[model samples]
Target: MNYLLRLLTILFLTNLSASANVITLQSTQDSLAKYSIPELIGKAEVTKDSVYLNYLEKKDLSTEELANVLYMHGNILINEGIMDRSRQYFERLDSVAKILKDPFYQFVSKLSIGEVYYRQKNYPASKESFESAHPFVAQFPEGIQRALAKAEYVYFYYLNGQFERYSKELEGIKKELIDLGEQGKVGDEDLDYLEMSKATVSVYLTKAYLMNEDFSKAEEELKYSDKILKERFHNKITTTAVQQKLTKGEFYFFKKDFKMAIPYFQEVNKLGDSENFGDFQYVARVMASIAYFQLADYKQSLSFSEAAMNHPIPIADYIDYEVEAMRYAYLASKELGLSDKAMQYSQKFLEQDEALKDTKRSNFINSILNNMEVSQLENDLIAKTKSNYVLRYSLIGLAILIVILVLFTVYQIRENKHNKEKIREFMHNLEESDKAEKAKQEERRISKANAEINSDTPAQPDDKTVKILDKLEEFESSDLYTDSKMSLSYLASYLGTNTITLSKIINTYKEMNFNDYINGLRIRFIIEKIKNEPKFEQYKISYLAEVSGFSSHSIFSKAFKKSTGVTPSQFLDFLKEDTR
Candidate 1:
């Protein structure tokens, strides 16, 4: 048994003694239960699963019989979208199956644990489970059990991004499933499960091909997948049918045909009793949101992304889906001019993304361990040799580094002094030029106003343009633009115009796009304040950034440089020099 599974067995053994109806570990009762776990799982009566579990718990079961109960419980928990509890049952099943030496349960239990991990965004652990189950692949009898296990193993390759390894495993399982069907090896009892397995494999294969950007191959896989579903399901909207629909939507989604992708995804959203659901509903809603976003339909995109966020499971349980959904929700909200909601979604996105990165970091460490673990002695030897090489090079590199640093520091100090002298002179000239520029601007404003009065017309501007320009002058004179939460839509709405019109007017008269125009105004305002207020010189750039509508120090520095050809630090340096 795997160490994790062994640990799970020890953990759950106390549960067996909790019920009065518990069977002794040494009991010699018949191992087979009246209801088959696999069959019950296929029925997927999620609502009535508690009744089934209650009935099973009351029975006197043997060692292998207990495995069946565990498997059923695991399947139920998984269907209910409770991954952590489902994982415990799977681990227990794997432990019991190992003791009984049952190939089918052993394989399925390990793979089920893997599926839980995959859904939990622990792909590295999922990969380990798949690999650990590999030796049991051929041990299963060539029927529904074997086909399902092999199909799962093959699907993991696609999940783990090992598409190059996918073709061989996929082809092998497809042939096995085909042979089982052609030879009539599958019994009526196993037919439905077998069909579903075949359909699942085909659908995901199509997804893999589409993900690979192999549209021709993807279409070929789709044809095969559709044929299987049409023949086996006949529009029944089974799980496999739902998966096939999602695959088709993904095909068009990846092809950049957002319009064509919409109906397929919408159908999936309404498929069966779709209960705010599992991976299927989550994926469908997320992809539909992305498709709508691609088509610039912000309202529809926000609707779908919001629906995905409202999935039955907590957002943390499905980090990948949460990240994507939160990201798009934020973007859609932003595009629709909902700043408050956008900021909330943005914070959620960051939280989910950080969690995702943490999982990735663990996987990265695991990859390193796998690559280095030839043997303990070899690892020790390699570490010693690597450290020795590092130390030997470090001293020489440190000397050279120190010498370069000293020289660079000296050069920088002198360069700084020279730059300060140049900037001091430039600032002196700049102050004179500012007075001249202000006079010129005032003269132009007076000239234009007087010209308009004399001619009884504004210069080249229509009445509406003139009104907007006047409102803009009033807007500029106020500190309302200093709000860092400002956006084009907000400004447009404030101006009592649409974004398109506001943008065009800004671009035409201001000779800049909306953001640049706002930023330009902010930079100019802050510069005048910094020049006039002696206390502002004592403040930090970060504070200045926040007060001036730039979100951060770096952004403020860049904008100040772009507008004035001098960084905030350089300007401050010249100011302090002038003050002294």
Candidate 2:
């Protein structure tokens, strides 16, 4: 009786295991049905938790089902940007396929692992993964899987700049696909997937042809892939379509047909907008901005470049795009006469360039124009347009100039009012500080009296002298020294004091006559301006003198040299050097 009971118990446990395996397998199949293999191939939408849960629930599945489920889980993880976790799933699938003696699954697992590495930009690891899968190609029967594996290998070769190897492998892949079709071994579903593979292969081939300067061949391949995508796939929003547009845009851009390239790049951007296409969107924006810039549409170029720089992805993830965007932004801003913005973008570009200095990617950027080249181009453009600009402005009437003068007067009036408010606030703060200091002094005097002791000290300034000195400091801080027409009487009246007391205080405390003091302040202000405003270095000496409150450039230059041990031009050169 006991032996019979144990036998039944073991049989029941076995059946329960079988039942659980069936349930899990069914769930995995259901999940996969929602997302086909073709959809999973490129930038597919995936819920990581749902896919992973299906994998976890799977139990005692057949070898093929187990491998498929595992591959699906890894592919979902890859799409979700969980690369490390995806690698683990692919590795597990590889091990399982090895154990089951299934070369097809093994090849696919290895290929998926390579794709993960490729997305991470781990070129060496990705290449090794592809190499490992190459040995299993013969074991893979002629079908969609084999075609995909071959396409992936070709793409890897193309990306690594192994164009010769890419060409050889791609020919073999094309011949094999043609033979498969003639053999009638590919059904409707398999043919659909094969078309996707062909489209991808065409994209890589197009890129290779472009890189080799074979424009005619590149265009042929591009049109072929685009037609196949539209006719068969109905121009669906797939990775193949996105890549095709990108390749076309790049083709036209390199050929200097920027207007022709813009539409292609825009199509790519629109497609990638809904998916996290990982650098494709970034490249699209950058290329579009470049095309617009080359077409001399500064506003559109600036807009696109700004969009690229402020993409949702972290800038660090796409440093190359960030650098390119900054370049276009600088160029556009400079052309649009946004001097301050141009300088800011240029500074950012330099900083990003410095960070990439020791990287292999730096060589790629170096292929583009450098800072000096861009600056020279800007200068040349300015020189070429200067006469036209002067002629355009000269056609305007004196009424426009008078209107500008009136506007400037209004601005000056508003600025003076703002400055007066700021001065009032500063004076209030100083009064508070003075009261606190007086409280401390009184406390000390009381302490001395309580101790019945007296000490001799120099007398402090009289109240009137102290008030004048405080007002003078306030006037200087308020930038009233920048007023070329300022006079002692005018300032003293503004301070509610007489000019003689103000002059006496200024001479006694500042140790300089009124004119010398004002000149020193202006010199200091201009030096600070040169340090802060990069555009200031480009100004003429006369303009500098006009803005710095001097009547003549000679006096301004002399005062600047006496105060800072450098002439204005010398100081400007120093600032330029420091920026570089």
Candidate 3:
């Protein structure tokens, strides 16, 4: 049995490596490319170098041919789970396409980049990239490329868990593809390609629909994929494996048949590691834990949860291992009457939870601003280099000016001209060195001040507000509220004072409610940043609000309007207009 298990692991690894070699360059002939998918699933050894050779020998290729080569390179890399590399190829292709002035390449490139980020599980980055590109799909004059880019975006958005955006794109892509085909603007090959791609996208849409709990739509979309697979493709080895696994998993998950879902999850896990991260394995583990817990199988639930925490794949902060696992560990231990183990687990969990709170972004920023201490001695080397640059430049300029003055005074004092010149040069050089040294010191002071002011660090009521604001003078800094979720109780606890005392302090000094006081601080900070720091002008108003402790964009906007009697954007425009 052990020997058989070893063999199974090897086979799984081999299967994944083979799957990673799947190629998808647009340069391949339509007929040949259509068969490649099936052949690849059959473990055919088709590689990217072979595709490159085929294209390289073609002497008289059009702009379309080059674009296709780049598309293929990007596709293979993406399939193989190398996102950063795939992004580079797609970005290059986009540039080429833009140079050719083809909207198809432009849209396709954007769609490809978004898909890469989606696979990498960077949903925010993926959403931003796709939304930026989606607007161009409608403006592209008339091209099959536009339809293809739209379809790609729709498919990947579904993967990114943006079901609403996915559905909207789906409706738009279907309509446009049909309209283009009916008008005879797109060729037959292009139409077939769209059909095949859309079917693939539908598979994901089915998954998304199921996830959204729209069972009827999920079933309908899966059926459509099934029909396309049966009618268009001759072989179904690998595609069948993926489709069956997905369908079974979703079906069981949606039905809440946790026990029934176990087998499918097991099958997916047994498939071995793919060239890509075994995300499905982790997913299965998480779901199995959930299922076991639901079925009252505490031991199995704890075991599965532990396995998930150990999985090599790293997800975002959506879940943390220590927190989730410790919860299960404590509960399971207590239920099993292991009192000693339960206490140990609970203690560990508390310590880790405290660490997380301290590391939260807002808290970190607050610490920085409150400290107001630069590691000057630690940055001595960097400061020395900067000072040297100023010293060197100033000395050179002073030497030149002194030389000019000496030459001008040469005719006036012929007897003592050389002596006077020496004295003048020495004095001039000394003056320049002193000036440069002072300038460098001033620069460091200004940088330290800016760092303090730029910080959205929370302030404690116990700290002298006068001293805090005094430090702002060097850089003309202003305070922005740094804590959005901060409450009076929390503040009072931190400051070693009651809410009433803090309220009185603010009322007497700042003359405003907590809300208005915070907003006023933010508005002042924003204005100072815009006027003094050029780069702050580029930051979105929404980001500024977050940095300033506004909980949401709407609240930030309302506060800005109330404080300045103008929106943030309007304020920015006014600043720009004044500068102009």
| Every model's TM-score | 0.55, 0.49, 0.40
Q: Give me the displacement of residue 341 in model 3, in angstroms.
A: 12
- Measure candidate 3: CA RMSD: 21.7
Index of the highest-lDDT prediction: 1
TM-score between candidate 1 and the true structure = 0.55
Report the C-alpha lDDT of model 3 over 1-580, residue by residue, as the tens digit: 0111111212222333435446444444544434443343322223434454343425444566566566666765654456788789889888888888766567767767766775555667877777867777676555544554455545555454355677667666656765676788766545544455456556655655554457788778777767766676535433333544645675676667767877777666565354222545555565566556556687887677667666534322123434545545555555566767656665565565565552222122112122111111112223444666888798687769877777867654563444445434544654685577467547555655665787654443333543333332322233324666555445545555544445445555545654465566666666667779878778998898887777667667877767655567766665565577
lDDT of every predicted structure (CA atoms): 0.67, 0.65, 0.55
Pairing residues by index, what is the TM-score of model 2? 0.49
Q: What is the Cα-based TM-score of model 3?
A: 0.40
Q: Order the numbered candidates by TM-score, best leading.
A: 1, 2, 3
> Model 2: per-residue lDDT, tens digit, 258-306?
8898998887787666654544666788889878887789999999899
Task: State in Å the error of residue 407, model 3.
Answer: 76
* Candidate 1 structure lDDT: 0.67
